[model samples]
Target: MLKPISTPTRELVNLDGVWRFAIDSRAGAEPWTGLLGTPLEAAVPASYNDLFVDPEIRDHVGWVYYQREVRVPRGWGGERVLLRFDAATHAAKVYVDDELAGEHVGGYLPFDVDITDRVAAGERFRLTVAVSGDLSNETIPPGKIEVGMNGKKKQTYFHDFYNYAGLARSVWLHSEPKTRIADVTVVTGFEGATGSVDWTVVTDGVDEARVRVSLSDAAGAPVATGQGASGSLTVPDVTLWQPGAAYLYELTVELLDEGDSVIDSYPVAVGVRTVEVRGHEFLINGEPFYFTGFGKHEDTAVRGKGHDDAYLVHDFQLMEWSGANSFRTSHYPYAEEVLDFADRHGIVVVDETAAVGLNMGVVGGMTGTPPFPTFSEQYAGAATQAAHAEHLRALITRDKNHASVVMWCIANEPASNEEGALEYFTPLVELARELDPTRPLTYAMVMFATFKNDRIIELFDVVSLNRYYGWYIATGDLATAETYLHGDIQGWIDRTGKPIMMTEYGADTQPGVHSVWDQAWTEEYQVDYLAMNHRVFDRFPQFIGEQVWNFADFATSNGIHRVEGNKKGVFTRDRKPKAAAWALRARWRGLEGRKPGSDGSTGAGSGEVTGADGADG
Candidate 1:
């Protein structure tokens, strides 16, 4: 016999308005000390840059201190108070009433601290958070070494991206009952289309509980139901979800005590989609669809990565208008709002983990000391590898319900020559399969180093090649580049039956700049580059898709090719559209009614033809 589940009423306190802010140099500085008597001002979502008018002060790097006072509800005395941060860069030390509370390391992931113990009922509690902006080395995965900007004789390599260090995402206070659901795990299968949900319910009393699970469709119609013990429930005949026609199913789990009185209930939304790679073609619901898109960075000109909801909505609209049906959350996992937008907009997402820059190498130079010994150990130790596998499992478990996510990218541009990479990636691939067998696992392979290991390629369901041919290799030779790209992909297809996706390809363009010399900075050059790739894309049916190098021009600390960052966006950093925007729109809008593989198929009226043409520098 099972117990009925009860749902708790959740109240969200909007901590968005302004609070008091100050900059401190000391490591353990506590803002709560004088906060109670000091005057309070607007501080919500404000950046350190907002305070300084001087250029030097604006760019100064150190610790920024933020403080706020919130009154706990009189009736919410027994309830648990959770302080949640959507994101905090680098490192953060949280304090309540001058008492040290908790600390967090990673900048991108969401974390919360139980601050109930530190807060008094019906009284205003002072909360202070000190965040360090010291990015001397990449603390996260995919760490890099670079030449230090301070003009030190020694060269340093670091991760690329603007260090918009602060509370770049959001902060909130949530209150929940003592007896509630701690976490839930939902897994789907294709065999008879069954779904299972494991619930970890927390309670105070030793009363036996019953759980009732029900499934609903997008229209809120009941499709399946089941009853089970307090721990878990399995529902069968689940509706299979697919991209483009993403049909989401809602699961409601209710808890009841021994008296059969409902105590708490919780609901989670999930999509049942099966993804598989079969020899150079990706199958979604047993059909084929081309994945044309770009790599995304969570950066803007003014806001850096601290963008709001409107920014995300505009970015997605640009992708959809540009004929991009897919996007890679490049180098790291994006904020939850970004993923949520991707879900509703019907965009295919390759949810990449924050595991890039782990192995930074110099051309013709010997292997140097790696950044962050933690990552190095994780790459080398079996136990650490197992821990990384669990980290990936948590990521998958948290995001598996999203229909937009079709693939899980384990690592980005890891060292192909290093033996540790092979050892580390093999287990990750297996772990991804073990956790969620519904989706395929993939890693971005450097084009020049693909031949080093045939065994590594075997583990991936789809073979993704990141080629910067015309952009980096033969910058002036388009024809030779296309020929090489075509031949290389063909050879790989012959070797591995796994589907192929040109994971990355694009040229940098200075938005709004028009050049007659080579059109490199002009929108014409951007369109020409895509037109050339489309020619090759039309010839290769085995290639599943091509994601452009980037979706927007992002801030990079490391400048390459005399550019501060990769200026490869079809739009500027400020979300302004380039001339190439409409050109891409014309191409993706049903190929402009031109037959596939037909010469002069480009609808831009630029007289560009579909063929391999050589150009002299």
Candidate 2:
């Protein structure tokens, strides 16, 4: 469905900020059952784990509750009022005045329910949401709470990032006309300097509705216009969206009554570009485009995994300064505003799902041999497969219209070697193709698949590998890593004959630590690690992209091995750059006298590049 847009005729109220919060640790304690005892005030759109000081509150596994009172807009009478959540972690159940309004599974997508019949205009109602981070074997990012020797339980998952839970995104109360536009799907094509757009507009109610679609340039000049629920429009002399020179058009789809008076309208900023993969080449607008960036997470210090505006702005500026043109949403889809900003900045994205629960056996490290136990058993389970499909549908429905999303990564580092993996992924891949034929589909290959020739590689249009050779496997052995990494890339290229992209490759490094002998966790080792990988990447033309493991240090499970969080980020957790950050800047931005991989060999004798001279963009 189209995102609810605020217009003159529609009302949009943000229900963010502080809300009454409580934890329901008792079994069968339904937080939505309306008996919320004097709860503590906590910030909405943030992980509840990090907001409190109590260890129990920070480590609670069961249902966490949020309650708030909202007054419906007095002017929203006779309109279709809806409660929308940008996203809630893992699973959520919503109640309005003790009546169940909606429930949704999966933490990475938006969900809403129409409350028009449940409330009156200008009336105050109690809204409560029960958010659960509990995961079973069937759930994505599969993990379970294990009671330790000290009687303390911890959330152990296969994913490297922390499992931050709660109302992680925004919530809104939106009202539009009873008979208004429901959704709009726009597909664009480019021919020389002209652009053709095919649109499908879906609406609700029985009013005699007519749809008017208009495309305007960046300068507010009309470029193309069309009138229909499903039709095409052509704009002459269209400006194509290119890397570093992003040109966008404002697409406004309006719903009008028989009298031609507009009732509701939705405006989307669109970039006209085409993405395709042809035999080891990633073509954007018919030109090969190399991706150089990081596979990032929506993580900050105090907010946990909450989406923050300041962090977003800072991350974008840092990425641009590092000369990055793209990044995958890593293991899940990010906030909608991030994708919109990417469209504006001409940054390509490999949009992914939160379906990151494939590995259940090997927890702590990557360099382990395994027929890992199937905790989720998702490959053979029908219910898990069905849930995964629904999650994919919701994700595609939400972000399909964005121009920045060049590819769809269905899963990250799944157990491709598992018994029923073929059966599980086959239909999922087919479903993605049916949902979006315009984009390429691929999942990040884990080390298991990389070490051996896996049949699952044949299912993807583009091959993506997330190998940790030097860090996880070789343990600072770059020479041996070079051999393994090069062979792994060649195996995928020979097997699939498709363009390859290294989605995850980085080493954990303490920001201030320095070692003369290139020890692990030292800043010098991190730089050399990346530089070695780049040298190998340059040797193969089939390699189209290289996204480091993470953009910055982020919080993970409080394991015994972890110091604070995952220290693999080029920058520290607080957004300060490390030596590796400068190394990346020099290489990516092509600064004068800063040529990385000049020796094209991995050792202690590697050339040094500095980030000191890097200008803040």
Candidate 3:
């Protein structure tokens, strides 16, 4: 008889306390091994700035070593022990008991290393991890600065966010049975307005496992159930989930043996909706709904990249209040909690990969002396392209089952004209279709819309353009901006006859300031900009939806336009709503005949219609 699958309780071993930290300044130094009496005390999951205020500490860029001692539980014997890092910037090399455990790259995603073989049960062991953020490492993605040397063509990124390098997220010790469920992928489909759930389970075990998958409504009542072998199962007659009528169904999958003893269980909230690009217009369940949202960066002023559920929820409320129905995870994949909230709140998402091809010069046509040697073997060559492709693949595969995700964007502002860029992009688009055919494929095109490269647009199910109408080109020239935007988009529609979305459009507004030198900082200007866009939006039959340039104020190291940062969000950096919020809410609510306080009070639940947790007033 098999054990019934049970939900694994996450017991967090807080590694946030003080840990021994030191900077390794020597070039190519072996992993620090010398034992010292007492080291500089620094908190785990804290930045170097949190402990010291030296300008050198702030500007210093290199490897930082952290050491700590932990005792393995005696009861944890025979179980597979895993060390999970919520996040570590750049590169992390982990060692246990002087044995090299593993290394991981990429700062946003979660990674774990199995330490069962490296450490004995009930034994005290010293764990050392060295983290490096050397800007010269080609494997590490460029951030904040650009380096040009000897025509070896390596371009650093000039982004608008702080480079908080550390264990910026969480770390934990997870224990699981040697043979357990590995992963789960759940997908939902809506046919004729009815929904169905399909799930695939990956496991490692010799015994034949019984799998039970259950779908529940928001109130936690079982709506559908399916049972099968430890592989795949399909549940029919699921509740159709919509954007405003976001009726989410929680999915629980359990691995069990013939005896009904539980083994392991995993749960994820899922919504059921159909998204398609139909002849120039994107449709959601055959309804024409406009997208009004912003791009979001997963960073905070104080928290850095630490996962904060409350902050995420507050962001959702602010967006909904500002009349947004959709958003994009700009430049990278965001936290799972953000996506989960989107699923429940009915916010459409353009789940983008961590591939921001900002280095691609074709978008802005910024041509200069090439940075790298043209024909050199290491000329930002195929290996870099391949690494990027692999990263994109991992991102897509990791988040494929998310129902809120309406499109897969392979690269953001990539160098389209580069020799092998299209070569990399085309295969990724094909791979996205192969993995999940339900959603469309999209890439953000900037500036040039000539048909000379329409072939790239033809490969995608939907073609999107990120136009900076009045901001970058002409300020206060609303009529000209509209004419240009409408003409370019209509031309694309006439050429491809494919569905189109205005993936990005908005002006930067400095919150709390009403500037007479052009209302760039005033809420009035923000409202007028969106209102004018709505006029053009009403005329464009081919356009599906429009997501604004940003949702909230995010950290940007590169402060441009004398504005200190990208002050484009409808809300301030602290998630405070600007005066434009009310105007957007009125438009989104479509509340032509309704009066304020008609539903009773004026608080979270006082409005006639609630906006994602009844928080819009």
Which candidate do you rate higher for lDDT, 2 or 3? 2
lDDT-based ranking: 2, 1, 3
RMSD of each: 6.5, 5.4, 8.3
How much does candidate 3 score in TM-score?
0.83
Q: What is the lDDT of residue 397 in candidate 2?
A: 92
lDDT of 3 by residue, 1-617 (tens): 01112247222255556677766653234543543234465666555543566554544566777778877777778877778776676678988866789898776566788898887778877877777654432342444334347432222443445556677666667677776767776666666636666777777683534777787787898777777643333435556667666877787877776677667666766777778777656677766556667777776665565566778788887876766778888767776667777777788889877555334333123331235432123433455556556666666666776777888876565444345545556776777777777888887764533334434676788777776655554557766666655566556656788766767677778777775544455777777777777666555556666677777666554334435556777777777877666767877667323222233221111111100100000
Q: Ten residues in a row with the worst lDDT in model 2?
A: 608-617
* Local error of candidate 3 at residue 124 (angstroms): 4.0
For this target, which candidate reaches the highest TM-score against the unseen true structure?
2
Best by lDDT: 2
**Residue 105 alpha-carbon offset, candidate 3, angstroms:** 1.9
lDDT of 1: 0.63
529-566 in candidate 1: lDDT tens per residue?
Answer: 76777677676566777787767787765444438566
lDDT of each: 0.63, 0.79, 0.63
Question: Which pairs, if any, clash in model 2?
Answer: 137-376, 141-357, 142-357
Instruction: For residues 524-553, write the lDDT of model 2, one tens digit per residue.
Output: 999999988888887677778889877888
Residue 64 of model 3: what lDDT?
Answer: 76
Q: Tell me how many clashing residue pairs each candidate has.
A: 35, 3, 20
